[model samples]
Target chain A: MEKQVAIVGYAQTGYESDVDASREILVLEAAVGALRSAGISREVIDTVVTANNDYMDGRTISNMRLVEPSGAWLKDESKVEMDGAYAVLYAMMRILSGDHDVAMVIGVSQASVFPTYVPGVMTLDPTFDRERGLLNEVSAAALQARAYMDACGVTEEQIAGISVKNLRNAALNPLALRRMPVLTVDDVMSSRMLYSPIRELNAFPPSDGACSVILASSKKAAEITDCPVWIRGVGFSHDSYLTERPLDKLGSLKQAAERAYAAAGISDAKDKIDVAEVHENFAHEELMAYEALGFCGEGKGSALLESGATKINGELPVNPSGGALAANVACAAGLARIAEAALQVRGEAGSHQVKGVKTALAHGQTGLCAQENIVFILGGE
Target chain B: MESDGLQNVDMVRIPAVPVFNWSVGNFMERFFDGLKGGKFMGVKCPDCGRVYLPPRMICERCFAKNDEWVELPPEGTVESFTLAQVKVGEDGELADLEAPVLIGMVKHEGADTCLVARIEGPDPEEASVGMRVTAVLDKSAESILDILSHYVPR
Candidate 1:
């Protein structure tokens, strides 16, 4: 068996539309705050992994200016050009390899700094997809949404319900960017339609945010913090080309979730895991994720929404921090999910905290239609 | 401003536009060469017998080097479509078009993947799933955009 790893500390800045602060300040604040929370200084960190996108940053080597701020000064440092959850995965591998006892992962992005959808467009197949110039993140998501809705007989009202539930839940999360104290499905349905079934409120709001996670081996985790969220399992997978993969289902996410469940010895996710933090950029995807994660049978996600099983006070609460629909900062979104899931396991999630979350699942994805996926399972000591 | 926690903030505009000439690579080079000749091209994996539309050098599942290049018909069935209402401008604000364009994903016969392109030569409401469509090749086509301007119901 590989060496055990645990999350000892994490910190996140307020999710806002425009932070008006430099990227350096955003990264430093999260990293330093996480170190303080863990009761450890820079001297204790053996390695650092950072997640940032060069296209989004408008600068190459997005981590160039972040080495010092990320507490990787003179220590082994690397980067994940995708989502922040991948950075944490890399840090876990480094510690599990026994080469590093403690690792720090940081993910920071200011979505307001650049044209939000342009970066998403740049990731398309430049040879064909970009030359056509019709699809971006939202449009591609709409295409996927149309396919999923048509395949499963899911109505636009179901999609609106997800946005309403998540946005209303955001009111309880002080750090959420787009909080709605009172939101209704009717309001979400009446919002301007961006692409056929996808309404204005169904899409993720652009925001500036950053988050950090400190991982330590079991031996060091015990000494650093009394409340350690044990990293029980990890899994990641990438689907084929956008044009090639099936749009109706999250095939890659299912593969990733399966691997994670097998690793964590979770035979039944619906019964075993008490809470779930899914990085769903669009409202309809939260419903689709329930099916992909094996919480319900295929094409039954819409029925799951009506069952109210995923509510904050329901049988299994999902996205107690409101998930990415509340505030999606691109590279930072997945790490925020991890941070939220960790809090749930630690019994420190404040107002949105579930009653008793023993084991929790955190999910993240990247690329069009969530082509790349990663899943993590966290358990409390 | 202090109440919102944003005080004395200044903005700077740094203009950066990078020009890159990406290589079309070996397989794409062959595919475009066929396009230049007014022919639809796809490479067939000898092991799996699956034809890739934007022909890949190697088959993802079979792991076999695709050595057979096959000429495909220009007609396909519509897998999915959307009448996009809003478009994101360079400024990231939603922009409006005089009329929404019909976009369709057409899967060519003998091909595994759908080729996403604009649906032209038909009314937007007339478009439906599983409709047979043919690609109208441009005789003087220089790129993928020019080769097949749009797809029409066959």
Candidate 2:
């Protein structure tokens, strides 16, 4: 029989403007919370996985900060510089492979702790792209957003609707930073425009937060929680990093979602999935993701949003916990998405709960949707 | 293994093209002037079709060679854009530039490439996908970076 992997515990620090706590302290707080939630001791964790970027932290070998807090000082700890979902998936793989009975995955980013533009500046290719002083993530996404609009006819108002909805949802989430009393589509439309087509409201606030999840094998999971969210499928893919590729479509995300759906034995996600938490740092991306994830036919993703199919009370609620667009902390955004979905399946989500969420999908994307996509499928036992 | 000072330290004075000095005045003067001057120029790729705006010494895609200089058309479309609320220097020092600077990817007409530059003339909100923009070159500058700022829908 294949080894089963399940998420037993999850914890996250409330998003803040500036976390005065040290990086180690942040990790420790999350680790302790997860341990308490899982009702397990530190000894039960057989291995560790951490997701972070050195550029975000302004240090080389940034993983050094997690040694003590992650309980991996001398344990088998692997570091993934990409998204947290990648780390979570890797942890699941390790637990299923029988090399580890229990695993802990942690992701943290303190973008607000560093200089505002440092991470963006660091992302530039030092040789060529950096010389031109490209305005980091925002600029890259803007390019893709423009391309997407040009090719797909996605209106700016429709994209703004995503921000309005997510921010409105964030108002109900205690962990979100930019919650408002009332958010209207007009508010999003009138919000300060950062990039043409992408407004300040459409973009995620720079936040400092940490999130963690504990994974266990079937045997270990049985001892941890009766409502473990099983990791049925996981997929990751990367495409050409060069900007020369077509910017209109996310080819890599499509492929990764296909692989993940196949692995999960999900033939038709639209009918099978109960909830989805996609990484939409920019509002228009949520619409694009609908097509890429096969939630709807291509060019019909916006229609799904317009039809209220992805609302909290809709057929398939998306981002019930306020997505990255609400409280994104870069490295932690992907893992947070998975954790939110897992919480919904475990019936542990408070306030922003989705009814009968049995099957959930979490997606994590990096680098202007140029590629480096990860997908996960978690189902209630 | 013996340690020789010369072995670890190889000094090379490679031939280089100074693209733009890290100065707002210098960048604007060079880039804006390049656009007004009509003759569109980009750092040529001796190896392929890849072109670099604000010109680079090497091609990022292939890393093969980038020596041939070419004059390109000044027209392109707005890819995506943002209005910056703040500006800073290389050393993290704040610069005295107008807040909410409009920046975007300007894809040269009929070219397979795009560049990041200042989007001038139109309101940033009015700037949209497929909006036609041309290089507003400064006539006095010699470097390509002097003429890189993009102008309104033409």
Candidate 3:
């Protein structure tokens, strides 16, 4: 919070069910692409932070094999086993601590390599939930969806509308894996039903992708790029376990957003923030996040969706990049949100770009029902 | 870098299973004992007085140790439920069920937190929030799943 940090460059691999590339290749492509985007070489980066999970990678110390590809062979390197946005937070700390001027952060996951839902099951309370084997990611989200609908009058149709919007927006993002430009809510409703109210279209498609972002201190940012997107504020919070916590709302996201807003001197998010890129693992979560981020009053996420404020061309467009629901790459999904927000701020998001001139909000989440949440406020000077 | 004809060569399935043993602790041990005796038990926190099902050693909210055990009525209200039409296989693939199964989060009368389990005795279409259900213990139990067979509509 004391030092100014900015995103100098970013890059992502094309998301797909099978990227036809090994984990190392994905990491190498993203890292090299990000360096090229920043017009800098690996020598300029003082530290490298990566995001990955051992369980998901099917190997211990999953980042061990990714060092050379990440351009961190000899440089100071570390890893955060969370979303890529969390790794960015760590890289920002390295620069803010005066120990590093520039840092490279990468997040990657190859969902095609292993079972996507198994790792989710491994995160459950081992003695009860895991042993019972009754609850998994889709079922948990389905339970949350039903609870939210019961509490907030959110219909299955409204939840399906979210998928229709994001999958349609994904049509514009060349890197997105799922693109249904003309997808209808009825189509989503008719998709293969996994659990009650959670059709296949309402859930994230597992994909293989990687994303890398270059961060620099205020002094080094201008040297890296003239159009660096400043990190105005950031906050992260983790809630209680999934079973113990209330499912109707995102309590941790609310706390994280409040802290980030206060740090950025943003009291009115709806008016000040021009664009938002949110990580919604499920359709209903976007609605829940709207309330948590104070974009709307509690239990009014469906109403906000109906008001047309969160569409790609609306007043405060959310997830113009298609979000996780479009092409979720697990660890990279959160980082992709940051990349999308930066592009939006720079007016470089291509067809999905909102007419944004100043500020943007990007969110990342981990855990079932979004128990862990991070919010970032970005701005361009 | 284009391998247009190498789709099959790209992936190899490695089937590996790693086993682990976790200690359920004193509270859960006793709760399982109660289940074996056809009783539902929970731990009551001394400070917050919040009772936790699938009993735990400490209350998360009060940050205090739970020394007292409370016996709860087998009946509870279904706070929320999902009619699962598909099951995630061991390989994490979704397979359709021959018939739908009901999973409910039931808040017992004396407990603060809800217990998640399968609900029986009601069709998927008939299952709704606020439905009352009672636990049905198995005649012979080996695992938690066996002891708490399912919750049937009351």
Candidate 4:
């Protein structure tokens, strides 16, 4: 890398079932709020990258309508129809190329307006899976959950524990929508069953929100803020389609985290990383991610959870902001994870703040059964 | 702006129905032809020997054309399954089902990959992993839905 990149500023719209505001307004608020947080003006932004999906927006080239609100008007702007974490990756590359000094990356989604689960079906293999119509995000996750359970002797009760943990964590985050500070594992198990293993409480709540982050060269980041969270390392990987790939394990997430840990010089993640914010669409995914992210060994995620190691005040906390289980803003969830990690690093994550956080990991994923994954390692020093 | 809330907001629904004519290509065309003759057809990768059901043109792992066509047996083991209590409509809206449907990932006798299909015989609670099941083909087959009815306990 020619130049180190850092996150200077970040902001997120309040996560809700319906934010009352239009998509453009949400984008504008997040974008402007991020600039304000950085103490920089819109004119200082050299490039803008957005994460949005045309199908989800129910419109084609949705970013065109967002140009003005995103402060990307007449500037070098583009969009990636993936998680906002990927957009941040693009913005980092742009700054690293020396072609841009500062970049604004925004990820926005209005899951309320559209049929949320329909888009997951649209991402399937059009020829066979679409016609069969047997799989969607939740059902597919149910299959993976079942496979993981059978392979490792993980019980549904163990998976339900994750919901109890994260939703309880959401209570501290005022911006979070699904705050269940006293949620219990039995409450999750008793929640309406969608698929056999995936009950209603086990899945992410569809949410409407936007997240924006300002990335700059190290020199520019220093000028923007005193507490710039450095992007120590980043890695992303995509696996085969859902059916062809092994369902029991998150192979791509493991590969992505390995690459990131290598780049960040993290030989022991469970010891070195202080906090983690992950995008787990389902409660089981967080457990799967625990193994994939090197927080635990294979099939040992449940044991780690039972050990209370991932609790808010534990040795290594995960998803202290409640995670996607509380408020999944579609494309923005990953970026919001990054933002939450940055907040932790800056000692600004109120209520849910962990004491003495120096290093953090943020993860984002797309596709059914987490077919694609991105990992970012952040540090305050 | 603070005055705006969920109350009295104007909402308009736009009906979207787009049509697409997909070409299933030569490999599927052959597979369908084989299905018409009461045979389960799959393509084996020349390099990796991974057999893909609903036969594809290329193998992802080996990066080579899947030129070998293999005949798969109707019987397979259930790798995993779900008792679906909801059904997604054409517009992608989810609605509760009167009775749960047992859907399984069935890996055929000779194929490496699994095909997701509805399993008919077992009660949702009775269905377990590694249970042997056989394909119940739709005799007067027209489409994939008609040609392959559902799987049943062998």
Report the number of the highest-DockQ candidate.
4
DockQ of each two-chain model: 0.51, 0.16, 0.65, 0.65
Interface RMSD of each: 2.4, 11.1, 1.5, 1.8
Which 10 consecutive residues of model 4 chain A have the lowest summed lDDT? A1-10
Give candidate 3's TM-score.
0.97
Candidate 3: misplaced stretches above 4 Å?
A: A1-3, B4-10
lDDT of 2 by residue, A147-260 (tens): 787787788888887887787778778988878648888998898665566777887788888899999999989988888888888878877543555677777888999999
lDDT of 3 by residue, A239-345 (tens): 87766777889999999999999989999999999999999999999999999999999999999999999999999999998999999998889999999999888
Which regions of candidate 4 deviate over 4 angstroms?
A1-3, B1-9
How do the residues A95-192 of candidate 1 rate in per-residue lDDT, one tens digit apiece? Answer: 98899999999888998888878888888877777767788888888878878887888888988889888888899999998899799988998988
TM-score for chain B of all predictions? 0.85, 0.56, 0.90, 0.88
True contacts kept of 4: 0.64
- The Cα RMSD of model 1 versus the native structure comes to 2.2
Q: What docking grade applies to model 4?
A: medium
Q: Judging by lDDT against the true structure, name the best candidate.
A: 4
* Residue pairs that clash (backbone atoms under 3 angstroms), model 3: none
For model 1, the superposed segments whose C-alpha errors exceed 4 Å read A1-3, B1-9, B92-94, B121-126, B140-144
